[model samples]
Target: MIHLKNVHKRFQKPEGGWFDAVRDTSLHVRAGEIFGLIGFSGAGKSTLLRLINLLERPDSGSVTVDGQPLTALSASALRRARQNIGMVFQQFNLMANRTVAANIAFPLEIAGWQQADIDARVAECLDIVGLADRAQHYPAQLSGGQKQRVGIARALAPRPHVILADEPTSALDPKTTQSILDCLQDINARFGVTVVIVTHEMHVIRSICHRAALLDAGEVVEILSVQDKQVSAQSALAKSLLEVA
Candidate 1:
């Protein structure tokens, strides 16, 4: 449901040079599967995720999501298309001042939903994230896991076709990570939203990903299926990660 072909992206370094964030990277994410981009810091995993939603446009290649060429869309069309592509971030990115319900309602409000519809969607999303009783809670009052759950609820409130999660469990403890992973897995099975997760942790990939691309230095080295081996991702870095663990 998503494709990136020969994509390249770079940024100006603060030291007066160009740094390539993504280098001729190509990847495909099948529908209704959790695809993980596994790599270390500076490996461009996050940049790759942004390309799928056109948050970071490629310098040279094509980005297609759900059969639409994201790079070819006009600004207005892209805005409309983005509603079908929800994103969950590592930092939670919640407005400290807004309650969980209000935070989840922000996207629906932006999409011009009626107040009644927004209220229904927000409550439904809170229930999905198992935070129905926390609707009135603010970010400052919640735990790290709770904050991330709120982020997930906000992403789901739009009922997007695809969900791009960037290191969704990086901030939490091991137990909390498992809970979030389970939530993601449940969401995938129940909603059939194509999930693409970016993370440096091999445990994250092995835990929930059906298919994964091993990335290094902004290039994908190998693609592995969890159902086939049920272990490591089978790349050199992946082996190293297993060894370290």
Candidate 2:
């Protein structure tokens, strides 16, 4: 469903230096696979995800989704194409001004759905996330997991073709993290949406992803299958996390 070729992203530092956030990262995520991009804080995991969505354009190389060349699209065209991609942030970027239902309805509203259609989608999404009863609650009143669930609901409301999750469960406790992961797994199993998870949490990747890539120093060092069900004696990703010591 997604492909990247020789993708490079460099940022100009205030100190008159260039920082290579991503360096020639190329990988393919097949349709219906939960692909994990594991990396440390500066390993360019998030940069790679943003590159896929064109939020941060690549300095050189290409990002293609379902055969559409995202790098070559015009701004307006990219905007339209982006509608098919849904993203959830680490902070659960909900509109503080909107209620749970309103926040879930936001994406549908952006897509120009009718009020009735938006309401229907919101109801369906709330039910899927088991948050139908809390539809009136606000972010301030919800737990971290609940807020993230609302984020997932909002992302799904648009019926996106692909879901890009960045550190989705970082703030939640272990039990809550499992809950969110279960929800994600269910979404992928039921909807067949391609999931790209960029996270530092190995547990999250192992629990849900079908395949994974380990990133270190702005490069993809290794790719593995979660289905392998065997511990890596010398996992590059685990070593980056100091888990293999």
Candidate 3:
């Protein structure tokens, strides 16, 4: 469960003036549902995702996740709250030197988990991402898909209540992307983790999202529902995106 109300974020331009990255946007994501934020580059989908976790603190607005008002939280409180929210990046942001298991265990370690518990959680996450056999492998040794799986495993190692994936499949080939999507779908179905993904690919939304928000120039254009792999497009931008799919 996530909600953003009257959210606005602005960045100072290099020369002068400010640029609005998110403009008075409001959205709600229900528990255990896969939601999508789709838009072209500069649409601020990624910024919105980061805002949900306060990675980019909004200039004005409120962000609530799992009933916690993230915007009002103290730094320590926010740190504790973030443990329940996981993020998967477009580029697999793995530790180049750490083995798969170590990478997955990093967050747990930071959370002060006992060594035994961290070990168990890492193993379980590795299995969930189908990377059990590669637990000892380094990021450089894996294929693109394997690397992303490692990223996913790391995200799941925290037993997070929500997962924010920013273009998780964009870096992989189509077949590999499908595999990653399947893994995410399985995670949502089996674990009931609320997932919010940011992607430009329509097929990514249609394949896994229950609902999606189309964004343009840092604002929400429309929210569309997906049923049986069909996206109900109500706006011109939504229809155009669907047509391209």
Candidate 4:
């Protein structure tokens, strides 16, 4: 339900010339599937994720999600469109002052949801992420894993059609990472939300992704498939990435 065609994104380097973050990349993600963008540091995986929601508008080409051409939308239109797309950041970007319920309620409130409806949705999301008992707790009071669960709950509060997770498990330990991935998988299975995750860890892809695009230096070098918990690597780069897994 997401497509990028000949997309290019660049940023002005403070030193001088421009640096290409995404270079003529094209890919499609099917609805209700978990897709992965795997790459090393500076590989543009994060930039590509932001491009899907136009958080970082592409310098050229098109971005379409759920059949809507996001690149052609006006400011207000884009803002409305973004409500259907949720984002989970690597660093758990929660408000320090807001309680867990309030943090999840923030987006629904901004969407003009009635207080009663927002309250119900926040409770549902908290339950989904296994954080129902922590609703009154502030971000500072939670452990790293609990904070990430709160982030996930907040992202799900809006009933989004797609979730863009940029390194959602990178901050947690191995056991915690497994739980987070399982949570994402459960969300995908139970709710049918399309997930496009950016992660450098091959195990993350193998554990959850059905298909993945391997990127290098701002370009897509390969598209690998995972079946029966096995990743099929076609290119040398893909093989190398798997070797490091």
Candidate 3 lDDT score at position 85: 97
> For residues 132-217, could you state the per-residue lDDT of candidate 2 as single tens digits?
99999889999999999999999888888899999998888989999999999899999998999988877777789998888888
**For candidate 2, which ten residues in a row score worst on lDDT?**
228-237
By TM-score, how accurate is candidate 2?
Answer: 0.94
Model 1 clashing residue pairs (backbone) = none
The residue pairs found clashing in candidate 2 are none
Model 3 spans > 4 angstroms off: none
Candidate 1 segments exceeding 4 Å error: 232-234
Cα deviation at 240, candidate 4, in Å, is 0.9
Which of the two candidates, 2 or 3, achieves a greater TM-score against the reference? 3
Off by over 4 Å in 4: none
Q: Name the TM-score of candidate 1.
A: 0.96
lDDT of 4 by residue, 94-172 (tens): 9999999999999899899999999999999999999999999999999988998988888888999999999999999
Ranking by lDDT: 3, 4, 1, 2
Task: Please report how far candidate 3 places residue 64 from its true position, in Å.
Answer: 0.6
lDDT of each: 0.90, 0.89, 0.95, 0.94
Worst 10 residues of 1 by lDDT: 227-236
Runs of candidate 2 exceeding 4 Å displacement: 228-245
lDDT of 1 by residue, 1-245 (tens): 99999999999999899999999988989999999998889989999999999889899999999998989999999999999898999999999999999999998999999999999889889989999999998899999999999998888888998999999999999999999999999999999999999988878878889988888888887887787537545567778876665
